[model samples]
Target: MARDYNFWVYIVTNEHESVLYVGMTNDLARRISEHRAGEIPGFTADYRCTKLIYYEHCTDVQDAIAREKQLKKWSRSKKVALIASLNPRWKDLAPEILGE
Candidate 1:
C-alpha cells in the first residue's frame, strides 16, 4: 500500500543559534534537501540554517499551516524552548527521521 503524505511544520537553525527558519511542507526530506543544496535562495540558505532541530506532524495541511504561523509569531526564546524540549541538544534529527 502507498503511504499517505502528511503535512509537517519544521524549524531549522544555524549552528550558532543566530538564525532560525520556520516552514511547512508535505515532503520533509525534499524540503531539507533543497535547503542543504541552497536551491531556495532566501533566509535559510543565506544563513546556512540546514539543521533540522524540530518538527511537528499534522494530518491536515491547514492545521500545519496554522501551527507554522503560530510558531512564526512566537518569541525566539519560546521557539528555542520548543525545540529544546524535544531535542535538548539541538541535534540534527534528519537521520533519526530517515532511520539512518
Candidate 2:
C-alpha cells in the first residue's frame, strides 16, 4: 500500500509583516516556491507574502481547507498571536521546510 501524504494549512506574511495570507496545499514546499517566484499572482504575489510563518499538517485535504478558511476569518491580532505561539520571533520558515 502507498503511504498517505498530509495536507497543510499555512500562513505567509509580507516583508513588512503587515499582511497575512492563508492557504492550503498538499505540497507546502512547492507552494511556497510558487509564492516566492510570484507565480501565484494577485494578493500573495502582489503583496510579496513569501515568508512562511505558520503551518499545520492535516491528513485530510478537507480538514486543511477548513483550517485555512478558519484562519482567514480570524482577526489580524489573532493570527499574529497564533503565529507567535508556534514561532515566537516570526522567523521565515521557508528554510525549515527545505531542511536547511
Candidate 3:
C-alpha cells in the first residue's frame, strides 16, 4: 500500500533574514525545488527566499491552508518565534524534509 502524503505549511527566508515567504504544498520537495529554481515568480523568487526555515504538517488540506493563512497574517517576530521553536538555529529544513 502507498503511504499517504500529508500537506504542509512552510516558511522560507532570505539570506539577510528580513523577509519571509509563507506557503502550503502537498509535496514539500517539489515546492521547495520550484522556489529554489525560481520557477514560480513572486515575492519568494524575487527575494531569493529559498531557505526552508519552518514547516507544519497536516492530514487535511483545509487545515494546512488555514495554518498558512494564519502565518501570513502574523508579524515577522511572531513568525520568527514559531520557526525558532522547531529550529532554534533557523537551519535549512529542506534536507530534513527529504529524510536526509
Highest TM-score among the candidates is held by which one? 2
lDDT for position 56 in model 3: 83
- Per-model lDDT: 0.88, 0.92, 0.89
Which has the better TM-score: candidate 1, or candidate 2? 2
Candidate 3 least-lDDT 10 residues? 91-100
Q: Which candidate is the best by lDDT?
A: 2
Find the 10 residues in a row with the least total lDDT in model 2: 59-68
What are the per-residue Cα lDDT tens digits for candidate 2 across 13-83?
A: 99999999999999999999999899998999999999999999998777887899999999999998999
TM-score against truth, every candidate: 0.90, 0.93, 0.90
**What is the number of residue pairs that collide in model 1?**
0
lDDT of 1 by residue, 1-100 (tens): 8566699899988778788899999999888878877788989888998788999999887899999999999999999899989999999987777667
Q: After superposing candidate 3, which stretches have Cα over 4 Å from the reference?
A: 1-5
Q: Point out the higher-scoring one by lDDT: 2 or 3.
A: 2
Q: Which segments of model 2 are wrong by more than 4 Å?
A: 1-3
Whole-model alpha-carbon lDDT for candidate 1:
0.88
